[model samples]
Target: MTTASGGMTTEQLREHVATTLTRGRERTAALIEVEPDELTAQHSTLMSPLVWDYAHIGNQEELWLVRDVGGRDPVRQDIDQMYDAFLNTRASRVALPLLDPTEARDYVRTVRDKVFEVLERSPLAGRRLEEGGFAFGMVAQHEQQHAETMLATHQLRAGAAVLHAPRPPAAVVRLAPEVVVPAGEFVMGTSTEPWALDNERPAHTRNVDGFAIDTAPVTNGRWLQFLLDGGYDRPELWTTVGWAHRVQAGLTAPEFWQLDGDAWSRRAFGVLEPLVDDEPVVHVCFHEAQAYARWAGRRLPTEVEWEKAARHDPATGRSRRWPWGDEDPTAEHANLGQRHLRPAPVGAYPAGASALGVHQLAGDVWEWCDSGFTPHPGFEVFPYEEYSKVFFGGDYAVLRGGSFGTDEVAARGTFRNWDHPVRRQIFTGLRTARDLTAAERG
Candidate 1:
């Protein structure tokens, strides 16, 4: 049976959609101002031309809300062909007949206006979005996700940084090496989160063995040790496929780093500076994370282990929505929502610690887990399968925790982010774990 999470009214949902939609628009507008030419430029094959993102957001709103739910006429049926992501490759998108920036903005405005009308008329109580105002929440989160993607394009773009957000505060204290999570059964995923996407649905029990995980993310200084120790040159430390790719890509360091003689620096946004020693390492692929763990005599946590460490309250046998409990995230909880341009230092947020005292489980960076992307036992695709189902069972790795680019409204301890094992442009990081047995040891 599909049931809705309680405690929110339709009016509250309405206002939330209005507010969040505006925020996404403001961010998108500010991003285009970086350099009009850059927005149209395809910075990398990994991302679409900026103008495509602009129109695609509006087109999605039209497809899901105005036309699909409201039974309204299409806003710009002709242009839908040009913006379909599944049909158009990122490389191919740049040459498509995309709308100009001015036309794109107008399209987004018109679609949002129609969507608000649909929200007003629809009874948000029968199914899907109606079941829990989920559609509205989904739309808001979608736009925010795109905004983060656009920020990635900005990072890859050549020019002065168009994006500007304060860096998170420095770490003030040291982290304990690891936190021990006692073995037991714990609930995973959720059936009650109003805005949860389909892949995270149908909360269920999972039995995880006892393990110890890092109390904080691996810092740049700590990762530097792996590099200095020749971790990359040792094929024995990396998987055969990973070793092959490492040599192919010339993977000496994280994506944005540059080694100069005896010194090291990395590019953040538009400027290059010496690496912050205490900050969590970002932009590392899973292969690199796996290699570092081997060098350090540890391992990456499995996705289930990752969740139990971050969510299981042994005292109550219940999971928290976030590391700090059932409450939603705030500025004090973690570094998120693009509020910062970079990860905070390793031990930055004591207040955000999990029940077991594991810190930084909520944000700063999305931590890679040692699991491939898959589905829950009772999974059912809602809205569409393309969002999550299509990506299942691929050569993808699951990443837990949100990132500095993550919008808190879209993040929860149960939330999931997945990508190819070789992706490094994302705000990705790692925290080492180890099995509580001898044979598992390397």
Candidate 2:
């Protein structure tokens, strides 16, 4: 059997389609507020009205995956009247009767189920492989896009006091200053394998002089030394832009971190807890990472350096889906899947180490790099143009790996995340690197 997304086998197409729907449902349930009269109040500038977004998601899925594919009409065809952003430009302007929260929820589920059934019943052969796959991939990515938007909306609506929870104490593990990357040239991006994102494309080769990266991400214990040395207090350690950001935000330490009677506590997810010495220091923005590196006599690695360290293959210069290998993520390999619901000790997953023996490259938290957000040579925008093109300015920094809350597919090694230096949320952190000359001097 084959699904409407003709490229994938019946099972593969079903899984992809189903997973997208599941994520939408999950995020909507988590973030949307229940209101009397089924009218969702807009609380956050980061989000559209909750009811509008909810209905919009379903309408989008139906339009792209069902109607665009020439499949049956959606179970709730009336949704197109009010929620279709493409068709209903005045949706917010007009006072439309909103779907009952229960009915809205069911509508999302019903559309997904009907789409799945259509795909399951479709014939395998003579399928429009490229077009169908593109349609499915677009909707899948669209839903993921909304997932992020909804998360931001939830945070805005709930306020910092309720949205950010504290993490549990992290286990301490000592780390060496450097892990050697043997001298070699490595393929730095995706090859002609499965679907490759545009930024990962035009897979290129580069020669990397051997160097060392910190064996684990810089930890709370290590960063504390930098802090005590008056790291943030000093202007020399900061870039001019960074210093300006510090003053504007009045950031004395990583966001959510506080000094409490000679000890440290940090606000995470929504609670406050004593700072754990061993966890990778998170909530630090790119500028903070840069400042800390300067103070510590180190620097952030370029994307090439990071990829060379991560994708090193002794023989055939190729990239691995993960730092370790092609195997899907498991809880034992990393602190992802919300298993611990917080960043674990940096060295907890020795198994997830990359080729150069860099640990936690796939999960726990995203590590900021020095590279500007630019396209790889010959890179073109994917179906979702907003994914990387809009953030090409130097204001954004490159972040590798996935965070505790990221889905497993998003955690793949080739996946790239970028954000502004001052916006710290969703488990951002950093590791450090030093020039070979400095390491030799030490």
Per-residue error (Å), model 2, residue 270: 2.2
- The CA lDDT at 6 in model 2 is 36
Q: Which stretches of candidate 2 lie over 4 Å from their true place?
A: 1-9, 12-24, 27-60, 70-107, 121-138, 141-175, 438-442
- Taken over the whole model, the C-alpha lDDT of each candidate is 0.86, 0.68
Report the error of model 2 at residue 279, Å: 0.8
The TM-score values for the models, in the order shown, are 0.96, 0.80
How many residue pairs clash in each candidate at the backbone level? 1, 9
lDDT of 2 at 172: 46
Q: What is candidate 2's lDDT per residue for 16-46, written digit by digit as tens?
A: 6567556656755665544533236555433
Over all chains combined, what TM-score does candidate 2 have? Answer: 0.80
Model 1 Cα lDDT, one tens digit per residue, 44-158: 9999988889888889889888987788999999988799889999888998878887788889889988988998887777876566677777877888888888888888887
Model 1 has an lDDT value of: 0.86
